[model samples]
Target: MSWTDLTATDLVPLPVVLPLLAAGLALVFARRPRVQRVVSVVALAGVLAVGIALLVLTDDRTLVVDVGNWAAPIGIDLVADRLSALMVTVSSFVLLCVLLYSLAQGVSEEAEEETESIPVSIYHPTYLVLAAGVCNAFLAGDLFNLYVGFEILLAASYVLLTLGGTGERIRAGSIYVVVALLSSIVFLIAIALTYAATGTVNLAQLSERLPDVEPGTRLAIQLLLLLAFGIKAAMFPVSAWLPDSYPTAPAPVTAVFAGLLTKVGVYAILRTQTLLFPTDPRIDQGLMWVALLTMLVGILGAVAQDDIKRLLSFTLVSHIGYMLFGIALATQPGTAAAIFYVVHHITVQTALFLVVGLVELRGGSTSLDRLGGLAKLAPGLAILFFIPAMNLAGIPPLSGFLGKVGLVEDGVRTGGFLAYTLVVGSVVTSLLTLYAIVKAWNKAFWQEAPQEIETDARVPRGMVVPTGALVAFGLALTVFAGPLYSYADRAAAALRDGSYVEAVFPDGHDRGVGESNETIPKAGAPAGPASAVDTGEGTP
Candidate 1:
């Protein structure tokens, strides 16, 4: 169908489908680098556009698309509520910027006759696949489909992580792969157990059926899901793999991985926790402690790191605690803040990594001992790095500061010792984050030269422009924080009010759509046909 002819239900799958189709076309045109770049950019641009449309459309209702026109609890469905729509929009925007950044890097490398760490022939297609996977996970309406989404991204990531085939890259990728596989296995078992208990893996159905399952079995299923998603999110003890695995990849790969991947885990956790077990105080309390430890441990590691990449990696882990803290409160205000924080972090973190790439390009290394004098040499780059760094540190008037304030207020309102402790921990983590970022700033930009700078290695405009655009986008978040947070609040309310479940099963039965199978002629009628209606606008 033409773009104008497509309805909201038709739009649900495009975010996932467009990228996969583009990836195939990109692979076919692999021999033509320019064609690959054009295809990748256009595809992601289309996703971004679709995501924006969904974001606006989903503000008032949730949209669901059954893959084969079969109803939920049997056929797969893709969902786009405010939460998933917001995620898809922000992620697609980040993916597009990162693609632009990588394209510029490729051009610069070609000019220098340097051997590329990321080959364009493979990079474009693989990156598109990764994008598709991320969109899939966000949009998936069932547990098994979410698993499929996770696997697609993980498979693509292994290729991107080890693009150079260098010993360091391969070693890091191996560590990453092993951890990912273990998580996947745990997730698979959780799905099996959930199905065994409830007879379906569809999330809306699970929400209805889980409470009726035996309490012990239900709790076990919840914990298994948590363990699996926690590892993927790099929560506390499970987070050890992240800092080691991310910093070894090409800058663009590392940037996307650091920015988007863990957030997917966080998204899954938020969705399941709110939708599947809204009343489970046990897991929520445990999550509070996990949030506290994740914050303190992650920031402590960041404080000790001298490598810019590793330091940021640690900070990435540290800040995840804040999102988890908001989630653990199990309150609408808290969940809203968490959603807002996730958006702020994705933009700010991705921009920081892109700036670090530029720093590495100019300084010849990410290690503090080997880098210095950059502020004097490249003032624009210094500004680019400084903005996102401060934003990440939760400096006042920034979106980060706003998100944290909302979380803290919600925690105090919750009024418990653990909640109070987390409130304190959040403050401490932000301060430490500032300290760590400042130390990197001082060593990399302010300190006297520890080694000769790469004066000949120009920071190409191709790279710098996209990096600047992302930095500008981060600034935009601060300016537009009000409406965004309101949207998040609405999303949180919907999660709590059973609106999503209602949307998925509008008839109060197995059939998600309004029409009935009995309406058709038994012999000649197709078993399932795509639902023509919009599943009705969701109640917020």
Candidate 2:
């Protein structure tokens, strides 16, 4: 359908609806494995296309879909703007590629064996449900719907994490489920308190009302929300659960989780911090310290790892600090840099994990000691690993480098002691990430294989193609850095400007408009500089 024919509200729901419908179809065709694969892939691909369309259409405007045609504060609404659209689109593409890779590797086929622990018939359906949840979380316009979205994905993830039913997988699944459940409980409680305090769960309404709350109560709510999201984002001190949980799932499952799940939490933090709690010096400074420590501790953990998957997991946690660094800077450029890095990291990290899966297939293990001579055995896999690994390391001319540069430049421009310190920490973390990856490379691809280890047969083309595609996609981010950065800059600007709030509550009821102290620009208005200050107690 043409953009002229389809309104933003009409387009907003399709990304969530298509996968959910396909998931039901997948369940009905459970006995037909080929149909299941087709349904899952097509559903996700459709969502990806819809997300892209929404991104283009909503670049300059907000798309708000009120389910059941209900009005704001009482009805369920799905809002799509540039930020949500970008996240959903990029995540959908990653999910699709991972699905193709999983199918190619015959993971579902293997699961079908009576001897296997996971139910093969349920994989496709569950996967689609997970995708649906992800899109829902991205598009949700209310706190309750966002909470529901998290529960949906976490439920499906509990199933996916332990698919093989091996003791290791089961143990890992238990930890993941527990951590996820605990976070959900906290999130639900936060929702309850927010409603009790403000009498509305709609984000736009909350944005308008929350600032008027008592400072102590407001800070408490912000902390509760941050604590819940921090655990989900795998932030430091609360991040102990991630490395233990993620490495045990099947490669594709781990890849997608590593790529997208924590990011959803980061997205939540981004939305809430910019909208609900605009400028709290205390919270921003606290987050800065957390970011620095998360980076240091996570990369240190990675440096001590012997296995590639676990190593990547630690690095994954480490890089989240980079995004948090942007958030902590609380400036336009910093937020823009964080957005760019999120996109870069999602593709680069997912691709790296897929390459590790291939390494496992070729060398029989992901252990550095067990894996060697891969460059000679599977040159394509070596190249795949090399590209993303270098990108992840923040090597020059890659998207990772550009992202870091943006962040560092923001820090420099902001010129705070904490910001400057984080710049140094970020550089150190980048170098350490390179060291860890190079250690893996030297042992897995450069060094000679241990005679005791038996190398598997040639790597499958199915796996290689997807991995290479993601790697190429990451490079494309660099090749087209100008436009991509511009888009990210716009997204950050839109968010800081309160365009989302305007879109959700277009009637302008209680939006704090025309108040002398109001700092937030009206809907469709340009946001002021990040440095703009307002003494208005009621301003956002």
Q: What CA root-mean-square deviation does each model show from the true structure? A: 3.9, 5.6
**Overall lDDT per candidate, in order of appearance:** 0.88, 0.87
Candidate 1's C-alpha runs over 4 A off are: 1-6, 107-119, 510-540
Tell me, by lDDT, which candidate is best. Answer: 1
Model 2 clash tally?
Answer: 0
Model 2's alpha-carbon lDDT is: 0.87
lDDT tens digits, residue span 429-467, model 2? 999999999999999999998854554587788888888
